[model samples]
Target: MLCPRCSLSETRVIETRTSEGGRVVRRRRECPSCGYRFTTYEKVEERGILWVVKKDGRRESFDRQKLLRGLMRACEKLPVPLDVLEEAASRIEALLRERESGEVLSLEVGDLAMEELRRINKVAYVRFASVYREFTDLSNFAAEIARLIEEREDKHDNH
Candidate 1:
C-alpha cells in the first residue's frame, strides 16, 4: 500500500482484524520509509443480487440507501434507534446474500423488512407493511391490524 504521508509505495501491515461479522478486514499499516502509520479496511466485493422485481415487472439495481430510507420513513418519530435500523439493514443484506440463486423477489425483501420491523416496533411494521404490500383499501389495513392483534394474543396465551 502507498504511504499517505510521503507517497512512498512501500508499507508493511502491522495489524489486521475482522469486523462487521467478518465481512471486512481492518488493517493497520506503517510506512517503512517515513514511519507513517495508517489504517485501512478490506472487504470482499461481492456483486449483490439483482434488483427487486416490482409487481409491475420493472427491475432496478439494489440500493442500500433506498432500503434504509423506506425503513426510516416507517420508523419516523418512533423510539427505534439509528443503530437498530442499521443492524436491521445489515441483517437483511446478509440474508439476501445467502440466497443460493443470487436473486430475490420484491415481496421477499418486503417480508424480511416487515419481520425486522415487527420485532423493532409494531407501528413501524404496520406503516411499512401497508405501503410495501400496496394495501388498496381500509379493509386491508384493518386486516393487518387484526392479524397483529391475533398474533399478540396467541403469544400471550402461549406464555
Candidate 2:
C-alpha cells in the first residue's frame, strides 16, 4: 500500500482483520519511510460487471466511488466518521450483490444508501434522502422528519 502522507510506493501491513462476514479485509499499514500509519480495506468483487439502470433507462457500469461520494457528501459537516461511512458502503455493496441481478435500478442504490446513512446518522440520512428523493419544499422535509420520528417511536414501542 502507498502512504497517503509521504506518497511512498511501499508500506507494510501491521495488522489485518476480516469483517462484515468475511466480505472485507481491513488492513493497518505503516510506511517505513515516513512512519505514517493508515488503514485500508480490501473488498471481494464477486461479479465481472454490474450495471446501474438510471431513471431515464440508461445503463451504465456501477461505480462504488459514486456511492462513496454521495455518502461523503451527506455526512459532511456532521459527526459521522469516515470509516463508519466506508463500512456502510461496503455493506451496501454486499447487499446489492445479494439481489443476484446483473443490473440494479438507481433508486434501489439510493434506498440502500439511505438505509445505511440513517443507521449511522439521522442528519446524514435526511441529507441523502433529500437529494435522492428530490425533495421540493419544506413540507417534504417535514414529512421525512415526521416519518423518521414515527419510525423511532415504533421501534421503542416494540422494545
Maximum-lDDT candidate: 2
- Expressed as tens digits, the lDDT of each residue in 1-159 for candidate 2 is 679999999899999999766778999999999999999989765757788899999999888888999999999999887878877887887778777668899999999999898899999999999999999999999999999999999999999
lDDT by candidate, in order shown: 0.86, 0.89
Query: Largest TM-score belongs to which candidate?
Result: 2
Name model 2 segments beyond 4 Å from true: 1-12, 19-21, 28-41
Candidate 1 clashing pairs, residues 3+ apart or interchain: none
- For model 1, how does the per-residue alpha-carbon lDDT over 1-159 read when each residue is reduced to its tens digit? 899999999899999988657776889999989899999978777675556777678886677678888899999998998768866887897888787876678788889999999999999999999898889999999999999999999999999
Q: Each candidate's TM vs. the true structure? A: 0.71, 0.80
Q: What is the lDDT of residue 153 in candidate 2?
A: 100
